[model samples]
Target chain A: MANVTAVTREPSSEQELPHPYLLFLGDTVHPGFAKTAFGLKQWAPELCLGQFALPSAQIDLGLPNLRPAEARAKGARALVIGVANSGGFIAASWIPALVEALQDGLDIISGMHARLGDIAELRYTAERHGRQLIDIRTPPPRIPIATGLKRSGKRLLTVGTDCALGKKYAALSIARAFAERGVDADFRATGQTGIMIAGSGIPMDAVVSDFAAGAAELLSPDAAPDHWDVVEGQGSILHPAYAGVSLALLHGSQPDVFVVCHDPGRTHLLGDEQFALPPVEEIIDLTVRLGSRTNPAIRCGGIALNTSKLEAQEAEALCAAESRRLGLPVADPIRGGPAFDALIENCLAAPASS
Target chain B: MANVTAVTREPSSEQELPHPYLLFLGDTVHPGFAKTAFGLKQWAPELCLGQFALPSAQIDLGLPNLRPAEARAKGARALVIGVANSGGFIAASWIPALVEALQDGLDIISGMHARLGDIAELRYTAERHGRQLIDIRTPPPRIPIATGLKRSGKRLLTVGTDCALGKKYAALSIARAFAERGVDADFRATGQTGIMIAGSGIPMDAVVSDFAAGAAELLSPDAAPDHWDVVEGQGSILHPAYAGVSLALLHGSQPDVFVVCHDPGRTHLLGDEQFALPPVEEIIDLTVRLGSRTNPAIRCGGIALNTSKLEAQEAEALCAAESRRLGLPVADPIRGGPAFDALIENCLAAPASS
Candidate 1:
C-alpha cells in the first residue's frame, strides 16, 4: 500500500520562487512538441525548470535540455510528460527513463490517455517511493448527471469542425473580448491544457462516457442574468474517432448560442481522412439543430475561422468570403476583427433567460 | 458478506414446472402496476407465481393478491416488486413487508430506480440469509462506448414523442410484420418490459449515461444484407425528463430509417405537463433531423400512432387523418392496420447498404 499524504500548502507570495518542474519529452517529437513546451513556458513559466529530449529528437523550443540528475540538482520537484502523441500512449522505451525519474523522488504528471497509474511497474515504484503520479487527463470529481434545465442567463459554446483546430483559443478570445467590453462572461474549459490555464474545469474526454455531459453541465452552471458562459468544445460530431464525446458535450452544454470553429485550410477531418469537413454553414446548422433539441432557442451565433496557416491578406480574404457566403460573422478570433464584434453583439442580443 | 452462488439451471421440460415468482404490489395501483404485472405474465409465464397487492388497492386485472406467508406457502422462490412508481423508489411502508419476504429465504427482483441492494437493513438481512437481491434496472455487463461506426444491413428505430407511449410496441409490430413477409428481422429491446420479453437486452436507462449508446450499439450489431434490425426506442428527445437517454440512443443506433411513435390522445409531454406535444409533422422532422446527424441517410419512414385509448373507429379515423397530414403511413401497431405494411414496404425500398 502507498503512504498517501494530504498536504495543504499556503499560496506562495509573488516574492517567493515558484516550485520547479522538469519536462520529459520522449522520442517522436513533432509540432506537438513545440506546442506543449512553449505552451507551458507561456502559461506557467513560474513552474517550468527545464525540458529533456532524446538525443535523436528533431525539434527544440529554446528550453534547456538536461539529464535527470541535472534536473534534480536544479531542484525540479516534478517531471511533466511534455510530448503529445496520437492515442496518447506513452512509448515503451520512455518507461525506463520515467521510472528512473520516479525513483529519484520527483512527482510525475501526464496528460495521456494511457494513465500512469495503470502502468503497473511505474505505479508500484512511485507508490513505494511516496511520490505523486498525477494524470491530468482524468475527469474531475463529483460531476452530476445533467438535468437539462434552463440555466440562468445565456451560454455561448465554441464547437469545432475537428479537434485541435482552436476551439479553446476561440472561446478564450471571445471571453476576453466580452470582458474588455465590460460584459459578464466566463470561459469554461473542457480539456487538459485549458484546465491547466483556467485552474478549474473538467477534462471531458477523461470522464466516463455516461457522465460526460453532466461534467460539461457542471462546468457551465447558472450564471447571473445578462452573463455569458463561453464553453470550450471538444471533438466534432462528424469526427469518427470522437463523436460520442462531441455529442455528449453538445447536449450537455445546451448553449443558448454557439460559435463554429473551423480550420479552412485543412482538407480532411483530423485523424480520419475518409471524410472531408462539411461546409461551415452545414456544421453551424447541424450544431444549432442538435443544441435546439435540449433548448429550443439555441442558435449558431457566429463562426471562428482558424486561418493561422494562411498569409494575413489571404486569411482576411477567406474570412470575408465565408462571412458573405454563410451570412454569419467569420474571422480568426486571435487576429481580431468584425466577426468577434458581430458574435458578441449577436450573443448579447439573445434572450437572457433562453 | 453475502454467500454468492453461481447456478446454471437447466431449461424446464414440459412435465416439470419452472421456479415460481411472487410479485409484490404496494398500496396504490395504477396502469403501471398492471403493465408490469401483466407484462411479466404475458412474456415469462414460467416465472409467474402470482401477485401480492394490499386489500385496499383498486386497479386489479384479475391477478391474485396474496400475503407474504401465503406466497411462501405457494412455493414462490422469488418476490418481484411489481408496482411501478415515479422515480421507482419503493414506498417506506412496504420495506418491512419486503424485508420479511427476503428473510423468509426468497430472492428479491425489482425493476425500480431505487435498487434493493442499496437499502441498508434489507441488504444486511439478505446478506445474512444468503438471499439474492436483483435490480433489473441495473445495466447488463460488458457495455462498450459507442464508436459511431456504420454496422452492416439496415436499421429502423422507433422514436417517440414521450415515454410509455408505445415506442417498443411499434418497433415490435414492424418487426413482426417483416417476419410475416419472410424477411430476416430482429427486435432489439432497450427498456425493462422489452428486456423481459427478449430474455436478453440492455436496460438503457439503468446504464451509466456515457455507455447508454454503447449498450444500444451492442444490442443491434451488424446484420446481413437483407436483414433488418428493429431497435426499440426509449425516452423521447422532446421529453424533458429523459432526453439525454433519447439522444444517446439516437446517436448510438445510427438507424437507416426511423418510425415516429406518438400518443395522439395525450395533450402534454409525459412527466412534464408544461410542454405540449409538437405537431406530428414537427416530431417526425425533429427525429429525422436529430438522427441524421449520426447517419445522414436516416429518414422518417413511417409513423406509429398510439390510439389505445380511442374506440376502434376513432383510432382508425385518427390514423387515416395522420397518414394524410404527415404524408406517411400511420396506424396503431397493436391494431391490425396498413401502417405496418407501409412501414415494411418503405424500409425494404431503402438503399440496402445505408
Candidate 2:
C-alpha cells in the first residue's frame, strides 16, 4: 500500500549505472551464487573500484576490500549488489551496510528480485541522500508472446550443463572475438549479471512464464543480415528449477549456432542436488531439438569449458581431449588463447556439417 | 499509485465468488480460445445461469443468452469471464459492458493477466457499485524454488499435446471420478478457469520464472497416504513459448502418473501455428523422461481425447483404434459413458506398464 513511486529508469538506464562500482558480495561464500560480482570483476574491471563484504563472508574477489565511505572517497559511483541466492532476496542483515552506502554518497544498484526501492529504510535513505536505486532486472512494459517467427541475421547462443558455468563469459568472449575479426556482432545478455556488464539485457528470471521467450526475441531483434547476436543464456535445460528459463531463452534466441559452457567440476546442479548436471552432449542435443522449432538451421559451435579448478596444462589437456572426443573446439573463454580463437572461428565460419 | 486498494479478498475469497454466474464472452469468435466458457458449461452446468456476450461475439455456450442486467435480475451474482485471448488481455471495446455488469449488481470475476482493477474506469465503476472485481490469475505471496523432493502420496497430472486441449477438464473429471469411486482425491487447479472452478489454485503462468515450479509444488503438497492430487496441467512441453511453464509444472507436481490430453482436431499449437503437436506416444515418453527427474516412478496413466468434432460412433472408433495403438485407455471425458469410465479405471487401477 506504500506509494508506488518505485524508480523507473529511462530507456538508456543501462548508461545510468555510473562507474567505477564497488561490488557488494554480502556474506555469500559460494562462488556460483556470487556470479554477478565475479562477472563484473572479470568483464568490467576498469569500471570497478573495490570490494565490500560482511564480516561473516568467506569469499573474496581478490580486489581491495573497502567500506562504503572508503569506496565513495575513492570515486566509486554505486555499490552494486553482486551475489544472487536461491531467491535473489535482499537480506535484512545487509540493510545497515546498504543504508551506509547511501549515507556515504553512493547509489545502490541491484539485480535482486526484491526491489531495493521497496525497502523503506533504503528508499528513505536514498531519497534523503538524493542517491539512485537502479534495478536492471525490470522487463519492458509490453512483451508479446513468442511469435515463433525467425528474424533476419545470425545468432550464436552460449548454453550450459548447469546454472552458472560461464555462459555469459563465453558470449562476451565470442562477441568480442567476432568484433576483433571485423565481424559485426553484439553480446545479448539474458540474465542479471550479463545485463550489468553489457549495460542492458532482459532479466530472464524476473519475466513471467508466458512472456519469457518473447522478451528474449525483443532483446535480440532482426538486425542486419550479416550481424550476429551472441546471446548469453540462462538456467540449464537440465536444471530442476530454472530449466524453463533456459529453454525459453533458447527458443526465443533461436541461435544459428550455440556453444556449450560447462564447469567440469560440478557433479550436481548448483542449488538442487537431486538432479545431476547432464553431459555437454545432452545439452547440445536438447538445445538443438527445442531450438529447431524456431530455427531449423540451429547447430552447435563448440564447448567453452570452465577449467577454473584445473592447472593450466591440465585444463589444456582436458580441452584437447574433449575436442578430440566431441569433434568440436573446446577452450576456456577466460583463458583466451589460440584454442578460444579456433572455437570462435568454427562458430562464425561456414556452419559445421554436424 | 491509485491507492493500491483495488481489492484483496481474504484467503476465503474463493468461497466469496458468488455463483449462479453469467458467463461473459467478449467479442471472441474462436471456440478454441474460449475454453474457459466451454469448460464451465461442460463441467459445472448447474452453477452457470446464462450467457452474456458482446455484439461481435461469434461463439456461444448454448445457454440462454442474456445481458448482465437480465442475468442479475434472474439472480445471477457474478459475470465470469470465460474467454482467454492470446495474452489474456481485456479488450477496451468490452469495458462498457463490464461497467454495465458492475452497475447491474454483478461482481466481475476474471482470470485475465491484465487486472480488471488496473483499468481506471472498471475500478471506479466497481468501487461506485460496491461490486468486487475478482482477479483469479494471482500467484500466492511467497513461493520457494522447487526442492525437487518427491512428496508422499500420489499425483496424477493431466498434460496435453497442446494448450486448452481438455487438460483441465480431464483433471476435473479424474478427480470427480475418483471421488465417485470412493477414492480419496482432490482436483488441483493450475490455471485461471480451473482455479475458478476448483475454488483455489496457483496461476502458474503469472509466477516469476524462478518460482514457477516452486508454486506448483506448493499447490499440491503432500497428501494422505493413498490420496490422489489430480493436478490440472498447462501448456505443452513441446510448445514453443509456454514449454518452460509446462516443464516447470511437470517437475514441480512430480506426478506419480499423468494423462495425455489432446484434441484430435488440433494439428498445430494454439495461437502459434508454426509447431505441430507431438503424438500422444511422444507426450507420454517426454513426460516420463523429463518428469522422472523429480519422480522416477512416474508413468503414463491414459489419455483423455477431445472428440467434439467427430460423430459419436467415429469418436468411439478413433478412441478404440488409438487405445490399441498406444496401449493405453483413451476416451472423451465430456462424452461420459462406459469408455470414459474405463479410461478412468485404467488410470486409477495399477499404473499401466508401458
Candidate 3:
C-alpha cells in the first residue's frame, strides 16, 4: 500500500478542530451516496462512523444506518452529506434531519454545490450550537492564474469518458499499485470528495472559470524528478455539462502520461442524453492530442476500466479485447488482478518518442 | 459600422454618476496608453475626453494630454490608468499624480491586474472624496460554472500567437466588416478594454479559473441562427504566461469557425524567452484539432494578420503569400482590404466533411 499522508487543515490554536466521525446522510437509491460511501470506506475508513438513512431506505453498502441521536451518541461529530445529486442542492426533505444534527452540536460537512452556510436556518442553528458548517465545494483562497510553465517531475493524470466514471478511483488505485512496487507516487485530488480525503487541492468546479487550469497547475508545482504525481481528473470532455472543467483540468494537469478511465456500459454522456458517448478510441486520441499541446511528450499511458457493472469474466474479456485493440495495458484497478501491476509497469517504462 | 450597443452599468439613483471624461494616465512611451486611447476612439468615441501624461512625456496618439488640474478643470471625471506594463501593476512613480487626481475628486479606473482598492492610501483618498475606484479587471458578479451546452447561433473566435498581438482588433475589424456586408454580427469582448468599450463583458482573466469558459458561454446565449458572435480571444496557446486564458476562451467561445491571429515578427512567445513561437500552420492545426473536440465542425475560417510592424507593401505581400500557402483568406483587418470579406465568405460557406 502507498504511504498515503492525510493532509488535514491546520486548526486554530484557540479551538482545536475535533477529528470528524462522519454520519453519511443519503439513501441507497442515490448512486452519489453509494459512491461517496464506497470512496470513504476504501480510502478513509478511519473517519467514517456509519450511514444515516431514512426508515424506508435500505442499507446496502454494509454500513449501518444509525439513528441521528444514536449517531451523535456513538461519536458522530459531523453529518456528511454523501448524495451527489444534480445541481448539488440539498433536498428540502433532508433539511429537518440536518437541522436536528446541527442543534445537537454536530458539525455539518457537504461536498454539494449548495452551501449549508447559504441557508439562513442552518447557519443560525450551527452558530447557536457552536457547530462548524464546512462546505468542501468552496474554492480555496488565492488561487493564482496558471502560467503553463513546465515544472520538475513526472506527472500522470486519469482522464475519464464522463463525470464520476472512476477517475479518482483509478488515480488512487494507480498510486497504490505504484507504492506496492516501491515507487514514489503521490495522489493529487481536484474535486470535493477527493479533497476531503486528501485534505487539500482546489475544488476546481467551485473555482471561478478563469483560474480552473491555474488551480490545477498549482497542485503539483516543483517536485522531485523521480516522483510521480497521480493527479485525479475531473469532468469529461464529452460531458456537455462539465466539459469546460474537463478542458481546464486537461490543460492544467500537463501530465507527461495519462490513463484513460472508461465506463463501457455508459451509453450516453451523463447530464446530457442527446449526445452519445464517443468511442473510447476517439476520447483517447482527443485526450492525448489536447494534452500534448502543453507537454509534447504527453501520451496515453494505459486504460483504467470501471468494470463495476460487468461480470468478472466479461470484464476480463473486455479488458483483453481493449488491450489488444488500443495496444495499451487495460484493467480495472479496483479489481485485484494483474491489470494494475501491468499498468504500473507500462507507466514506469520510458514513453516512445512521439 | 456594426450596430454596437454600449452595455453600461446603471448608476445608483442616490448617486448619479457623472459622465467620465477620462484622463488617460500614461506617457506616449507606454503602448498601452496609445492602444487604449485608439480603441476607445475607434469603438467608443463618445466616452473619450482626453489623455494624461507627465510634463516630460509626449502625447502622440493625437489626444491632448491635460495636466491633472487641467483635466479636472476641463471636465475629466475619472483618471484611467492606461499604462499596461508587465504584470499590469501601476508604477510607484505614478502614485503621486494618481493621488493628486483622487484628491481633486476624480474617480479612478484601471484595467491592471493590481487593484487600486487594495492600496491603503488610494482607498483612503477615494473614500474621503466619495469617488468610485473601478477595477475593470475585477470579475463580474455571479458567473456560473460553464455547462458546455451548445448554445443557439454561430460563433467566430479570433485566436492569436501571443498576448497583445491584436486578437481584439481582429475581432472588432471582422464584426465591422460583417456589418458593412449587412450581416448581423456582434462583438463579444473577453478583456478589460473590450469590456470598457462594449460597456459589458467579463474580464475573463480576472474570473476565478473555473468559470472563465462559463462567462464566455454566457456572452452569446440563445442568439439568432444567422447572427455571428465575433468573440475576442485572449492570450495564445503558445504563450506560456497566459495560455490558460487562451484555452478557456477557445473552449468557452465554442465557435463554429475561428480566425487565427498572428504577429509575424514575434520570433519568441511573449514573456518567455525560452520558448519560440511555433509555425503558424502548427498553431492553426492545434487550435482546430483541440477546438474540434467540442464542436466537431469547428475549423479555421481564415487568418487575421497583425502586420502592424510591417510596411503597407510588405504586409500586402505577406498576406498574399499566406493566403496562397494556407489556402485561407489572410489580411490585416485594420488595413482596408478584401480579407475580411473573404473570411466571412469562407465561414458562411459550408465546411468540408472532415
Clashes (backbone N, CA, C under 3 Å), per candidate, total 3, 0, 14
| lDDT per residue (tens digit) for residues B1-354 in model 2 | 222232433223344457778999999899988888888887778879999899888998899999988998899998998988988799998899899998998988888878888999988887787788888876767688888887888899999898877888889988989999999998888877877776567788988888888888888887787999999999888777888899889988989889999998988888766778788887888788878878888988888999999999999999999889988888998888887898888777765454
lDDT of 3 by residue, A280-317 (tens): 88778877766765688888888999999999999999
Against the native complex, each candidate's DockQ, computed on alpha carbons, is 0.19, 0.67, 0.30
In terms of lDDT, the poorest run of 10 residues in model 1 chain A is A6-15
lDDT by residue for model 1 (B212-286), tens = 667777777777977888889977765544555677788788888888889988887765555677667766776
What are the models' TM-scores?
0.76, 0.83, 0.81
Q: What i-RMS does each candidate reach, in Å?
A: 4.2, 1.0, 3.5
Expressed as tens digits, the lDDT of each residue in A1-354 for candidate 2 is 232234443224354456789999898878988988998998878878899999988898999999999999999988999888888799999999999998998888888878998899998988888888888777766788888788999999898898777788889988989999999988887777877787677778888998888888887888899999999988788777887888888888889999999998999888767678888997888788778878888999999999999999999999999999999999999998989989988898886454
Error of 2 at B289 (Å): 1.9
Compared to the true structure, candidate 1 yields what TM-score?
0.76
Instruction: Estimate, for each residue in A142-201, the C-alpha lDDT of model 1 and write its tens digit.
Output: 566656667787788888887789998888888888889999887777776665445456
